[model samples]
Every structure is written in structure tokens, then in C-alpha cells.
Target: MVAIIKTGHSIRAMLNYNENKIKQGKAECIGQGNFPVDADRLTYIMKLNRLEKQCKLNENVKRNTVHISLNFDPSEASLPKEKLLEIAGSYMEKIGFGDQPYLIYKHNDAGHPHIHITTINVQENGKRIVMHNIGKDKSEPARKEIEQAFNLVKAEHQKKKEFKPEPVSVRVQYGKTETKNAIENGLNFVVNNYKFTSLPELNAVLKLYNIEADKGNENSRVAKHSGLLYHALNGKGTRVGVPIKASRFHDKPTLKKLEKKFVANEIKRQTDKSRIKNAIDNVLLRNNIIILPQLVKQLKKEGIDTVLRQNAKGLVYGATFVDHKTKSVFNGSGIGKEYSAKELRDKCGANLEKLKGEFQKAYSRDDLLNMIKEDRGLLSIDDITKIVDLLSKTESTFDYLNKDFLKQRRRKRHRRGN
Candidate 1:
């Protein structure tokens, strides 16, 4: 089992997120304890309120909410609720939250069977449970003990570590089955198939499929650094390893060669828009697909990758479709305003009402646990336990999972979105 804990300020938002999913019938309120009404929303709110009310005695505790998810392997599916609760209780006791009131919510919306716990950090005595070094000092030890006691699959044994992009695996199966040949396959398919007026715009399409085109920084010391290269990317789109120079590819897709294609593609894509639009229309016409992930899967069958750009809050406001087979890039609005994020989301919302339970299978626990086995470089408990000393001082709630990645980018003079 893997545990991720976060400290936040709102009880309502966290509870509402899970409750909304439950109301949608995507999840269920499987079990609850230590509250007046165990099955209703009040069970969660009243307990959390009690914590906050007590914390008022302390006066300085601004952050009161604690959210944690316990994810188990697929093999552990059908794990009884009684056992799950026992594990949760043991975990709380080990982590110093045994006496604090909390609610456990089982979330099935993802590809794994997991439970969420929401509680406050403050005790009724108006004392704050020091969260310092909890992840390493307390939670880590508790997780291993729980796993051994339950005989659950250890994290290290989960899956291979390859970065397989979810909902878009169809692209690789169709062409470029080999990792080394992806450049030739993606470019041969894209260059002859799609249209783009610039390299950066083309890369937006390339980034979706893990084939990146690059020219070394202006002052790199390596000889022949001026040449363009192609690289593979991890799940996060960060480049990995040595790159294959543009000259090595059969088509010699160098910067100069691609610039020439850019002008021609502009004219070519103009004629191809109607054909491409029809393809997208055909998919949306189907009743089986809806929501973002399902829509991405259906489109991938035809070699299209739908990349949505969202703000920090996870609301997708813009989208891009990189057509690998035809090598075409179209903004949702560019394809047709009907394909824009707003329109698609609206359409998806309607279709979701009609989609059955099967469409959600892609997120099944088996599918999620399968990735862990494929997740190479996954750290084992033995490996983790070896690092006893710290490179920094005591790790607090902030060290638990507080990270802010700056998504910096230079504004493009040419608009990629319509």
C-alpha cells in the first residue's frame, strides 16, 4: 500500500469532491466510524467541525484539514471493508492521529482501489499534533507494517517503470512499435500527414507523442552541437537520454529541411481541414465515448492525441489535437468551434449521463496496479529504509508533498489557438 498525505485549509472542498463523485454514482460511501450518523454527510462535517471548534481554543492553527489516500495493488481487490478499516485505524494510531476524528472514503474513480481519510490535525484538548517528520518517521513505518500484516503486494513489486501514456497507447500499437524507430515512424506519418506553419507549433504536436525535435543551446561545448536531434520523453514530457541527430533519420528532418516543409504544410493543411473535421465529427457521433480520457482514447484509434491545457486548479480551458497519422495540428477552435474545450466538455457532460460502467474500466484497479509492475526504478522499502540520515532538517507537513513547479514559457508571437 502507498500513502500520500496533504494538509490543507478547507474541509468542505475536500469532502465535496468525494461526495460529488459519490452522487454521480462514480463512487460510494463504503464505511465510516466515530460519528453520530455514520452513513450521511453530517458524519464527516460534524466530526471535522468538532476538531475546528476545539482548535479555536489554540487561536493560531490556521490549517486544519488533513487528506490522505491509501492505494492498494489490484491483487488486493475485494479486500473486505472491515480489514480496510482495521488498517486505517492502525495507520492513524501509528501516525499519532488515533484519537482525532476522521472519515474514510473509498474512491473508485481512478484505476486503483483506494480510500481517502479526512480529519483535522488539532486535538480536542486544543493541542496540535506535531506533523514534523511524519511521512518518514511515522507513516513510512506504519505502511510497511500494514503491508506485511495484510500480505499486500509491496510497492517495489508493483510494475515496470516505463512511462506509458494512458488513453493513448493505441498510437504505438498501430505504428512505431519499436522505441528507436518512433522518430522515423512519427515523422513519416506526421510530415506526410499533418500541417503546421512553424517548428514550435509542430513541437506542440510532437510533445503529445513523445518525439521531440531539438537544436542544442547556442553555446553548448559539444562539437556538432548546432545540429538538430530527436529525443524520447518520460511520462511528464521531460526529455531522456542521448538524442538521435536529424541526419540519421531516413528523411533527414533537419531544421532547414523542416522549415521548407512548414511553408508547404500551411497550404496542404488548409485543404485537409474538412477531411480531418469529418474524422473528429465521426467519433463524437459515437455513443460509447465521453469525458476527457474516453474521448482521448477513441480519437487515438484514428491517430489523434487530444492535449488539454489547464490552469493550476485543473480546469481545462484550452486544447490541441496533434494528429500523428496525418501530421496535423489543430486547436479545438481551429478545427471548428464545435471542437473547442467548452463545446466538447458540454457534449461530454451530456454523453456521460448515457455512458455505462464499462467506459470507466480503463481506470480499474487492475489497470492501475499493472502499471506499478511496469514502473521501473520504483523504490523498495529496503532501498528507502537504507537512507536513515537526512540531507535537510525535520520534514514537516510542507515536506510531506508541498511542491510548486513553475510552468514557465515564452509567449508565441503567432497564435496556435483560434
Candidate 2:
């Protein structure tokens, strides 16, 4: 999970802050925090409006408004409300809220879970919170701390199966078409992964590279493409915008270089998914460990004792024990016989989970049913129906429910009654 922190006026404004910057690292206000580490960062974003509202920064300024904004993503262990309060309290303890105070506002207006802390530069104690390195000084350490805390929450949420997973597809909008397409395709192609964020910074880098960025409709001279844009970091650590024009720019050394660098990351992600799949399989196989407790008797009667363990393969696993001494092992006959429970979970169950989620989110049942029925070289209708039925019985069915079927069922019931 990505944790981003920045400051803005009226907690609402911070909540409403652009989501694009949080994901893509586009509209960034660097701060005093360590880079790429799990930590909380703080920034004193001089609000253009607040500054104009309060004529303190300049005579042309009109009124008293928010002078600084600090934002960060706290771990799920620390709820947004709690994190916001902690940030506000920490600042209050250090210097006390200024005449024009800062509030830690919980923002959900954007995609990623984030918060905003807006305050005046002047503290009540006559101490001033200075904006150093364009607020990089304050943002760095704060971001580190925030990441650390947020990571803990993420871990806990993962265990509880309640983690707010990110969207598979996220949209990124840019003020300029050149910048937008550059970002969309560049990041996707260069990174071989799709995520939203980084338009402004990408544009900034393109400007340096003399990439001729303009917002218009023109297919000539490399107009639109698919993939991702990566900031090509030179040996000197300066970012150069590198656009990966799919199919067209595949031969570029820069693209090849990034592919090599991120291949390891892709492998790691695949490995992690594989591991989680095995773990979930183990949980399911431990049928004796029933959530209702009553199922334990049924499992025992069937001469099945489910025992779960973390396999040497770095995945959770389990096996059926007929007696205290009799342990079930793979006979290498049918499915799941050759591979351990973890292997099966990762290979089939995990993917099923993702598919089921998408299946549930499917807009129309006919479309989904048709996809399933058609197989479409993916899954059989029978299998899809089974998953859908299973989802209906689950508690958090919102993400899995067949909304079209439910809607139709309601209509049919109403018609029958009429």
C-alpha cells in the first residue's frame, strides 16, 4: 500500500487534494523525510488560496488562512481519524496551533487512503515552523514515520482479510495530452506495470528532455500509446522522462534497461502471490478448525483431522490425518495430489479470488454469464456459477454478488406478485 502525506487548508481541502500525485509521484512537495523508507513525512505546502486569503505573506494577500499543510498515510492499525488526531496533537504539543490552526482532516475523496494537516506557519508559542527545502525537510522524517505506522496496519489488515486492496485499473488525468499519454504509456511500458500518478513530474522531466509536450489531438510524431512512463534516473540521480511507446519503442536501450531492473521485482511479486495462495489453501484444508466449532464433529466423523503448518516451501499447508498417527500425503494421482495445498492455493485459488472479485463487480450478469458460458478461453460456465453461488453465501458479498441477477430476481418477484 502507498502512504502519502501532505498538508492543505480546511481538512476537507486536504482530503480533496489531488489523488494523482499520491500514486504517480507527479505533483510532489518534497519534504524532510527519508526516501523510500517506511516513515511519516511532513510538508508545509504554502496554500495559494490561504496565502491570498491572509495578506500575511505579501501585501497583496487578502485574509488569514491556512499557511501550512502536512499529509501522510498511516498504517491501518492507526485509523485515519486516529492518525489525523495524532498529527494534530503532535504539532500542538510541539508548538501549539497557531491563530489560524491546522486540522488533521480525514480524506476519502481521493482513491488512496490519505489525510491532510493544515496549520499556520506561526505557532502560538512565538516559534515558527519553517518550510525547508521546499518543505522536503519536514516531509522526509514525517513520511518515514507515517509509512512505518501504516505498514503495520496493512499487515494486520492482510491477516484479517480486510485490507483495502488497490484497484487493478486506475485512471490518471493530465492537464496536457502529451504529458498524459507520456505518463500512461511510458510508465506501463517501462515498468511493465500499470498504476496511476506522476503526470506533473513526468511533464517536468519531459520538459528537461525537450520532449515537446502539448495538450492536443495529433497522432503524428508519437501521439498516443499504451504502457507506463518511468523517470529515467541518470547516474547523477537526475530524472529523465522515458516514454515507452509500446510496440514502437520496444527496441530502446532504456526500456530494455528498466525491463532488466524490474524483472526481479515482478518475480518477487509473483512469488509473494504464490506464497499467499498456499497459505489460504492451508486455512481451507484445516476443516477441523471450524469457525462454528460444530463442524469439528462432522470432520472427525469423516476420519479427517485437518492440521495446518507453514510448509518448507514458504507457504501455509495442511493435510488430512485419519488417526493421531496416520497422516495423509500426496498419492500423485489427481489434482492437488502432486503439489501441496499451498501450491494449489497459489496456482488456482488465489487467481480465483481475483477473478471472483472482478466477476462480482461485473456490471451485468448476462455479460458475466456469457463470458463464463462462452469460456472465452478462461473459465467454464459451471465453474463460474459455482464461484458465484459460493460468493452469495459469504458475508462480504458486495464485491462478489451478481448484481444483475439480484436485480432481475427482484423484478421477477415484483411481476409475479402483481
Candidate 3:
């Protein structure tokens, strides 16, 4: 089994996430630990009140929430819910949370069978639990002991299994899933996982999953009241479904809450900014000139996604980079001047005339046609169109020049200038 533990300040958010999954038919509340009522009999208010009441005991403990997921190998998908609850109960007892009130949820969304446990770290005596390195010092040993005691597949052995679990949150497909549930899933994943400093940065990450958080126009009543709405976007990036008010979600991802997140994320995402800048620099260094589309493609290969913002007139006005590796989002101007939309567009356009000259000198019409035939599978639609246009008019050539040859020529020109 693989165990993952996370601590947060909001017990409501953790509960809402799992409960929302239940509403979507992707998970179920199997059991509750240290609670008076059974899991099936408990209401949402009962769950939240229990955790919040304990959390209120110690106002000083900010990170009082504990959310844990116990993941099993795909081979154990048939594990009975009762057996899963038993394992969860034993795991909690071994880790010192046996007496704490925790709600256990068995989620069916991933390939592997897993259960999420939500609890608070505060005791009834208004004292905080020592959670420092709790996973390494307590959970790891408990996991090993449980694996041996239950005769289950060991964590080390499960690593060699061919099956890999899919992500819990996937891109929202229009009309495929419930609108509120899909948006909530995207919001839960992005809000918890990614460090985005502003609304646009958050939207950049959310856009990957076809979700957006919108605050109405400046003079609108919603904006005046600091209201926020989440909408599902179609394939064309236009909002299609009814916009759900932020307050409608259990977690209450309101403008006020997001402002607090923006402040925290600004500090958290700082160390990661340099890594994104370096990735962009590396891509720029490899080519004399690169359009936004090519730059976006190359960055994706490095596990970074670029979202370019454009106006109604189709002018590139901004750029935001979402680095999946680091879980960080950075606006172009936030990184440096060179990475800004205007500067990048200028750099891409600077050598276009020179690039066309190089292409013409490098390949003839017959050579271009043969090259296209040979690399058709490797070429993008834009590349094919450029090559076709070049064949029709000798004066117009594509930007498909040899990069190595261009680099060599650049060096020679530099030497001559010196």
C-alpha cells in the first residue's frame, strides 16, 4: 500500500472535496472514526461541526486539518469495503489518530482502490498534536506493520507493478459530466496543488481542464459585492454552462478566499520562478527565432504549459507558464521582460525576413516537395501549409530551415563582426 498525508488549515475544504466526490458517484463514505453517529446516518453539518468544534479548541493551530489517502495496488481492486474500513481503522490507531474523529471515504475514481481519511489534529483538551514529520516517523512504520500483519502487497513490491493509477481529476468534457461536479473537481485539484499568484495565473492552469473562475465587469453588482463565479468552458474556450456562484460550492471558493490564497501563493511560488525562466531561456537559445506556437510546444516537452492571452482582435497581449513539474504558474512579465508577450513576439518576428532568405537558399521547390513527402507525419499543419505556399510562390518560403545550419551561420557572422 502507498500512503500519502497532507495537512491544511481548512477542514471544511477537505470534507467538501471528498463529499463532492460522493455526490458525483465517484466515492462513498464507508466509515467514521470516534464519532457518535455512523457514517451513513451523519449529515454534512454533523461532519463539519464535529471537526470544526475540535479545531476551535486551539485557535493557535493553523494547520489543524489532516487528510490522508491510503492507496492499494490495482491487483487489490476487489478488496471489500468492510476490509478496507478495517485497514483504515488499524492504520489510524497505529498512527495515534484512533481517538480523533475522522471520516473515511472509499474513492472509485482512480485505477487503484483507495480511501481518504479526513480528521483534525487538535485534541479535546485544546492542545495540538505533534504532526512534525508524522508521515515519516509514524505513518511509514504503521504502513509497513499493516502490510505484514494483513499479508497485503508490500509498498516496495507494488512499485514494480505494470499498472499506474490515473489522476483523480481529468479535463472537463462538455455535456459528459455534471457541470458543477466537473468544475468543482478542477477547482479542487488546481486550488490545492498549483501555486498561482493571481486570478489569471489560476485560470491559466484551470484552462488546461476547461474551467475558469470569473469576476464580472468592474461596474457589475457581483464585482461590487466581491462575488466570483466558476463556469465550464467548451472546446472553443467559450463559456457554455450556467455560471455557478462560488458560494454554492461547499468549500466556498469566494473572492475573499482566493485573495488570501493569492497572497500565500505569491510567497510559495517565488523559488520556482527561476526554473521556469531558465526553461524558456534554454528553448530560446536553441533556435535563432521561434514563434509562440513552437515555443509553447517546446516548453510542453519540459513539462511546462504556456497559455497565451489574446484580445478580440487576436493580438497576443500576455503569456502565462504553468510548470507541471514544479506545480508553479508564472506570468511572462512576472519572470522577465524578454519573456513578455510583446518581447517574445518581437524576437520571433525579428529574423523572419532573414529566416525566409535562409530557407530559399537551403532548399529548392523539388527538394521541398520531397522533404514534405518524407516528413509528412512529423510536420505540423502549419508547416505543411507553409511548404505548400512556398511551392506555389517561389518568393514565399517556410520557416523550415535547418536549425544546425542556422546556428553555424550565426557563429560565422559573429566571428566576422568581431
Name the best candidate (by TM-score): 3
lDDT tens readout by residue for model 1, 1-418: 8887877666666676567657756566665545556655565456556556765766677777788878787667788988888888888888988887777777664445778887778787788888778899998999999889888887667641111222222233322324545555455445544587766667777776677777776665322444577777766776766777776654457777778878887777776566557767887677454455556667778777777765544456676777655557777788788888778766665543332233233233343233234421222232222122211212331233323321122223234432
Error of 3 at 55 (Å): 8.1
lDDT of 3 by residue, 261-359 (tens): 899999998999999999989998887655556677799999899888766544577889999878899999999988898898666555433445566
Q: Please provide TM-scores, in order, for all candidate models, with all chains considered together.
A: 0.41, 0.26, 0.70
Model 1, poorest ten-residue lDDT window? 384-393
RMSD of 3: 9.0
lDDT of 2 by residue, 193-231 (tens): 221122332232232222322222355333343233333
Query: Model 3 clash pairs?
Result: none
Report lDDT per candidate: 0.63, 0.36, 0.80
Ranking by lDDT: 3, 1, 2
Prediction 2 global C-alpha lDDT: 0.36
Model 2 residue 52 CA deviation (Å) reads 5.6
lDDT of 2 at 39: 22
Question: Once superposed on the true structure, which residue ranges of model 3 sit more than 4 Å away at CA?
Answer: 1-24, 35-76, 110-112, 119-177, 219-221, 361-392, 395-418
